[model samples]
Target: MTQNIIRWAQMDDIHDLAYVYSESYRKAYVGIIPDEFLDQVSLNERDQYFRKSLSEDKQKIAIMSLDEKAIGLLIFDFQGEADLPENSAEILAIYLMKDYWGSGFGKLFLNWGMDRINELGYANVFLGF
Candidate 1:
C-alpha cells in the first residue's frame, strides 16, 4: 500500500510546487483556455510566486505526497474573501498531476483542506477554480 500524506508546503517545496502547478494547468486547461494564455504559464514565475506567497502569514500552501513523492499542490486562505463573511475560508487553488486524476487522491486532498478550515472555526467556505 502507498503512503499518502498531506502536509504544509515549505520553502524546500517551491520547485516541486511550481512544476506540478505548471504541468497540471497545461494538461488540464489546454483545450479550454487559449494556447497563448497557457503558453505564458512559466515554472520560474510560479516558483517566484510561491516563494513570495509562502512568506505571507495569511496564505496557506500544502503539498500532497505519496510515499514521499510530491504529487499535488493546495493553496488556501483562512481569511477568505474580503467581500465574503468574516467567518469563512477560501480555497484559492488545487491541482494534482495528470496521472493522479480520477484516482481519488484529489478528493482526499480537498477533504484535508476542508478539515483545516473547519478546525479553524470557519462556518462557510468558498472555492476558486
Candidate 2:
C-alpha cells in the first residue's frame, strides 16, 4: 500500500529490526528451523548480538523500510582481505516480514545488496544459505 526502500542498518534501527526478525522468522522458518529455536530467539539476545555486531565493524546490516518502518533485514560479512570463497563476500542472512512477500521486495533487496557490494568496489559477491 505504501512505498518501501532498502538502506543500511544503523543503531537507530535495532528495535524495528528485532520486530521484523521475530515476525519474519516465525512465518518463514516454521517448517525449516525448529519451532523451539525460533521461539527461543529472544529480542534481548538478538539485540545483544546486533549491538555486538555493530561493534565489530566487519559485519554489515541493511534494512528495508516502508513509511520509515523497518520491514526486512540483510546482513553480510565484509571481507576486505579475500576472506570468503574466491575473494567474494558472502551474505550471512536476509530476512523480511511476511507482509512483504510476493510483492517482489525480496529480489529488490537482494539486487540492491549486490549493487551495494559493487558500490564498495567488490567485483564478486555471493550469499550462503
Candidate 3:
C-alpha cells in the first residue's frame, strides 16, 4: 500500500520545497503566463525565499510526501494578511509536482492546512495567489 504523509516542513527540507515550488509553478503557469517569466523561476531564488520565510513566527509550511519522497508544499500565515479579519489565516502557496496532479493530494493538503489553521485558533481562511 502507498503511504502518504503531510508533515511540518523544516530547514532541511528547503531544497525539496524549492523544487516543488518552481517545478509546479512552471507546469501550472505555462502558456498562461509569459514563457520568459516562467523560465526565470529559479530554484535557488525559491530556496532563498524559503530559507528566510520559514523562520517567521506566524508562517507555517507543510510538506506532502508519498512513500518518503517529497512532492508537494503548502505555505500559510496564521496571522493572515493585513486586510483580512483579525482571526483569519492566509494560504500563501500550495504546489504539487505535475506528475502528481489530479491524484487528489492537493485537496488533501488543503484540508490539512485548514485543520491546522483552525487548530492554531484562526477562525477564517484567505487564499492568496
Candidate 4:
C-alpha cells in the first residue's frame, strides 16, 4: 500500500489544492448543489481563497499527499458556534479526489486533523461535513 502524508498546506500547493477541491466538489455535489454553480467554479478563485487561508492564524488548512501527489485538502478552525463549548474546534471542510474515495484516506485525514486539534488545546471538535 502506498503511504499517505498529511501536512500543512503552503503557497506552492494552491493549484493542486484548488484542483482537488474543484474536482471533488463537482463529483460529490452533483445533484445536491446546482450544476450551474459548480460549472462556474474557478481554480484561480479557490487558489486565492486558499492563499488567504494560509495566512490566517486561526485557520488550519492541510493537504494530504500520496506518493508525492496531492490528493486531498482539509480545513479546520477554532471558531465555534455560540452554543458550543469554549475552545471548540470545527472542521470546516474535507475533500479528496474521487479516485481516493473509500480508500481509507478520509479516515486517516480525520484522525490526523483530530490529533492536531487536540494538540492545539481545543476542548471539543465537531465536523461540519
Candidate 5:
C-alpha cells in the first residue's frame, strides 16, 4: 500500500477535514452515542473547538494528508495542563477513513504520534478502545 504522509493541519484543509471529521466520527462514535445526539453534532463546532485546542494544547496535535486529504487524525490528552510527572498520556482519538482501516496507515500514524509523545517527554500513551 502507498504510504500517506501525515502533516499538521492548516486553514486550507477545513473542508476535507470536516468531511473526515463526520465520516470517521460516524464510524467511531455514532453507535456508542445516540443517533439523535449524533445528528445534532456539528463538524464545524468540533473543527473550531479543536483548532483552538490545537493552538493551545502543546501536548495535542491534529494531522492530515499531504494532498489535502484527511484519512485519519490523532489527538492526545485533555483541556487542562498535563500533570503527568512521568509523562504518561492518553490518545483521545485516532481514527482512519473506513477504507483505510487495515491498510497500515493506522499503525503508521499510531507509531508516529507515539514517537511525538515520547519526544515531548512522555513515557507512555493510552488509547481508548
Candidate 6:
C-alpha cells in the first residue's frame, strides 16, 4: 500500500512543488488560461514565489506525498478576498498530479485544510480554485 502523507512544505520542496504546479496548471487550464502564459511558467519563478510565501507568517503551504514522493501541493491562509466575509479563510491553491486524480487524495487534502482552518478559529472557508 502507498504510504500517503501530508506535511508542511519546506524550502527543499520548491523544485518538485513547482513541477507539480506547472504540469497541473498546463493540464487543467489549457484553454481557460492563455497557452502563452502557461507556457511561460517556470520552475525558477515558482521557486521564488514559494520562497516568498514561506517568508509570510500568514501563509500555510503543505505537500502531499505517496511513498515519499511528492504528488500534490496545498496553500491556504486567513486572508480573504474583498467579497468574502472578513473572518473567512481562503484556499489559495491546491494541486495534485493527474495520475492521482479521483483517488480520494483531493478529498483528504480538503478535509485537512478545513481542519486546519477550524483549528485556527475560522468559521468559514473559501477555495479560490
lDDT of every model, 2 decimals: 0.90, 0.82, 0.90, 0.88, 0.69, 0.85
Please rank every candidate by TM-score, starting with the best.
Answer: 3, 1, 4, 6, 2, 5
Query: TM-score, each model?
Result: 0.94, 0.88, 0.95, 0.91, 0.75, 0.90
Report the lDDT of model 2 for residue 11: 86
Q: How far is candidate 3 from the true structure (C-alpha RMSD, Å)?
A: 1.1
For model 3, where is the 10-residue window of minimal lDDT? 50-59
What clash pairs does model 1 have?
A: none
* Candidate 2 per-residue lDDT over residues 33-118, each given as its tens digit: 99888888777778877878877777889999988788899988866445455557778889988888988889999999988888
Model 3 per-residue lDDT tens digits across residues 16-87? 999999999999999899999998899999998989988764578999999988999998887656789889
lDDT of 4 at 50: 84
- Candidate no. 5 TM-score: 0.75
Candidate 6 segments exceeding 4 Å error: none
RMSD of each: 1.2, 2.1, 1.1, 1.6, 3.1, 1.6
Q: For model 4, how does the per-residue alpha-carbon lDDT over 6-118 read when each residue is reduced to its tens digit? A: 99888888898889988898999999999999997788888878888776656778999999899999988877778778889999899999998998899999999989988
Q: Which has the higher lDDT value, candidate number 2 or candidate number 4?
A: 4
Candidate 6 lDDT score at position 9: 88
Give the 10-residue window scoring lowest on summed lDDT in candidate 4.
51-60
Q: lDDT tens digits, residues 1-129, model 6?
A: 869988888878888888888888788787899988988888888888888887765688989999988889999877777899879888989999999989999999988878888988998888786
| TM-score quality measure for candidate 2 | 0.88
